[model samples]
Structures are given as C-alpha cells and as structure tokens.
Target: MAAPALSPLARIAREQDPDRFLCALFAPAERREALFALIAYNAELARARAMASRPMAALIRLQWWRDTVAEAAARPPPRHEVAGPLAMAIRAGALDPADLAAMADAREAETEELPFPTREGFHAYLRGTAGRFAIAAGRLLGAPAEALPGLEARGVAYGAAGVLRAAPALARQGRCLLPADLLAAHGLSAEAAARDPGAPAWRALARDLLDGGGLAAPPAGRLPAAWIAAALPAVLARRDARRLRRSGLAAPPRPGRPLADRLAVTWAALRRRA
Candidate 1:
C-alpha cells in the first residue's frame, strides 16, 4: 500500500525546508504536526525577501508576520495555510510567539541588501534567526533549560554554514553576506566579492567564517535523545562546511542524499550528540 498524503504544512516543509523537516520527523509522533507548522512558517519568513519585488514590500510582508505572531498570542491567527497551523502550534504550547516574531525581525536585515558591517553583527544575525529557531525546536521536543546553550551554539554554526551554502544564490541576487571588515582585510569590496564568489579572497573568508562558527558538540549523557534530534541539523551543517572547505564557496552545494542524511542524523541521535 502507498503512504498517506502529507498535510499541507508538511508538504511545504518537506519541499522548501527539507533539513528542518527531516529533523522534525525525529520528534515524537504527537508533536510532528506542530513541528511541521513551525518549519512551514519559518520557510515562509525565509522567502519573504525573494517573494517581494521591492524592499518596502518585503518589510511589509515581514510586518504582517510580526503582526500575525502577536495576534496569535491573543486569538486566532489570520486565515491562511501556514499561518493557521503556526497559530495552532503556538496555542498548543509547541512553539513560542516571541521566537517567531524575532525570526521575522531578523529577516528585516535581508531586505536592506547590505553586507554585515562586522563579524559580530553577522553572528548576531545568526543567533537571532537560526539560534532562536533551534532553541524553539529543542523546547518543543522537551529539552531541558540546561540544554539551551548547546542548541544555540550548534544552531549558530549551522547558520554560518548555511550562509556559505547560500553564497552563490545571494551573489546572483546582488547581495553579499560576507563581513565588510573581512572583505576589506582581503582587499575586496562587497560588490567585488558578490561578483566573483569564486575568488580566492572569498574562499579565505569562507574559511574564516567556518573557523569562527565551529560546532560545539555536547558531552555524552549531557542531553537526552530528543534534544539531540532537535539539533541534528548541525550534523548536516558540519558536513556542508566540510564540502565547502573542499570545494570553495563558488561551488554550488550538491543536494544531500536522503539516505546519507537520515543515517547521519540517526547516528548522532543514538550517540546523544549534535
């Protein structure tokens, strides 16, 4: 017999945000829908800039999400596919409205299409966006308060790798995420880096970012299996970092093999590490 069809939110997550979707599958069955809802909502926020033709339009869309999150706290969210499920997730205590709002606010930087002025600013962006998302996911999986720090560290590392992986696309969009200070140190400008992402200067900068964003693996027995599952995407992030190190930032990321990804996550989960 064939498998049942995925829910609308699940479909969105599986297609648009496969890494988080895969991690969500490791969550308890009862919590999977709520996790999917969060992933779908995040996917929507991540694409808001791309969906809008103008910077103001993208900010407007982000504002709508910020409003929706606030509204979800009091009553039903706006009627929409992802919004309704996200509000449900929020109401069910599976997600945090504050985290959702912060995620939306983080994307507001993207609309400006400006390179980060400093390394600290870049990492701050990762913390507010990916770090917060990881914390929210960990909480959903019943992770303890003590585990939040580890999750945030791993998530920031994952976010750094993600920026590297997204370099090619961002370049095509005429945006550069490389820190301005680093670019200047390497005798390159943001426009130059964006135009030639394959340049050796960019590769060196990629290495610098990766080195600074190293994953902090938790000690064995420090976390439960559920917490490990929540941070499993850090495994993939490490893998992608290795690939970029080998091939340079200019190389388009190869699609991850599903079997390999599942095995990696399973192994990490079994070891109770991220």
Candidate 2:
C-alpha cells in the first residue's frame, strides 16, 4: 500500500510547483529543473497528511513517504517528475538522499508532543530538520556544500523562530511545536494555550521567537546571496507578522496571506535572483 502512494511522488514530479520551479528557473535552467521535483515530492508528502491525528498513525504514514522516495528511485527518475529533478540536483550539487529523508523525520516530531529541554534543543532540531533543507536548496543554487553546516545553523534558527512565532495558531491542530518547558517557564500549559486564546505566555513566546529570528542574520553564502535572498526577507516578514498577531492577541485569519499578493511576490522574487 505504501509503495503505491509513491505514485503521487511521480505525478508531483511531473507537475510544477510554481514557487520552487520558478525559483529554480532563476538559476541555470539545467540546474533548477533537477531540484524542483525533489522539492515537489517533499511538498506532496506534507500535503498528503496535513495535520496530526494519532502518533502511531502519523509515524506509519511518514514511513510511507520515505518508502515513496525509495520506490520512485527504484526505477530511473521519471522524465520530468521528482526523481529526475533530484537526479540532476545530485549530479550538479552535493545533496544527500538521506538529507531529504530527514524532513520526514521532522514531520514525525510534530505527530507527538514536542518537548525541548531548552531553547537550544529546539534550535538543534530546527537545524537538523529545516536548516539542512535550506542547505539543499542552496546547493541547487550553486552554494558550496561545505558551507552547509554554518548555513544550516542560520536556516534552522529562522525555522525555529518561525515556528515559535506561529505557536499560537499552530496549536489549533492539538499539538504544540515549541518546547513545553519554555511554555511552562512562562506559567502556561499546552492545554491552556490551545484552549485559552488570552494566554500571555503564548504572546511572550512569540515575541521572543520573532525578535530572535529577526535579529539573526542570514548566513553569508553564495546561495542566499543569489536567489534565496529574495525568499528570505519574505520569510522574515511572515515571522514578524505572526509575532505581531501574537502580541496583539489577534486571532489568525480564517484565510491567510492573500493569494494574489503571494503569487506576485513569489514570481517577482524568482525573477530577481542575484
């Protein structure tokens, strides 16, 4: 059953994700196409199961995504699907197959309760899970592979910061992404956060995360120096917006960032890679 779910991996491989494909287009056309499929498959996996239900079920489902990656590769990467893009990325850059698999692991962490002993622990998770992903993107854009470790540090910080900023809204899914200890330190319970919209600790946490992320610099590198730069500011702005919402005690919008504006921004950024 799991092996077959991989079919979407193939289908998604062929179909283009506007943001990723467009970003890739900014680089060498030969280079961009290779990574688009890899990114698309990961996106598909996230879409396949939007939120958590049971940890056991979520873990099993995550395994399926991992298997899908394997199954897709069992045969030659499809003509235009994720496999081919990944194949190209591997040839042109320093991406590791297992690094992509790490994303699935990160998703699994969300399935169960997230408990970071300290903020540092949370940062570590962000780097391994999200930082590496940014590095993979950077690699496709012609950044040096050796630079990934430091760059990963910065990318993960941004990711953790984003998640922290969004903590209030994300709790709606009945899971908390921030460290439970941090919330407890502020005298809030995860249960209270999910149920109590007025929780001060939630806002405080969001403020800290946004400030932390906003003050942090994007790593000095060829990747963000090029196309990733276009994307980074927007990511920061989003973190800022979420921080504002949390601080203002405003509820998350029933509908998020308007699509038209988003499309415009995404397209414009991709076109301006430098």
lDDT of each: 0.78, 0.55
Error of 2 at 259 (Å): 8.8
Tens-place lDDT digits, model 2, residues 1-274 = 4443324443463353443444444445444444555567556555443544667776787786676555554555547445466554554444556777787777665555665666666666676565766676666566665655555655565566556545556667655667666677677755565566556656675666545534243433334435453244334434444545455334555535456545544554555422
Return the lDDT, model 1, position 140. Answer: 87
Where model 2 places Cα greater than 4 Å from the true spot, the runs are: 1-26, 45-53, 70-74, 77-95, 194-200, 210-242, 245-254, 258-274
**Every model: Cα RMSD to truth:** 2.4, 6.9
Q: Estimate the TM-score of every prediction.
A: 0.90, 0.67
Give me the candidate number with maximum TM-score: 1
Residue 232 accuracy (lDDT) in model 1:
84
Write out the backbone clash pairs for model 2. Answer: 13-81, 13-82, 34-85
- Provide the clash count, candidate 2: 3
Worst 10-residue lDDT window for candidate 2 reads 213-222
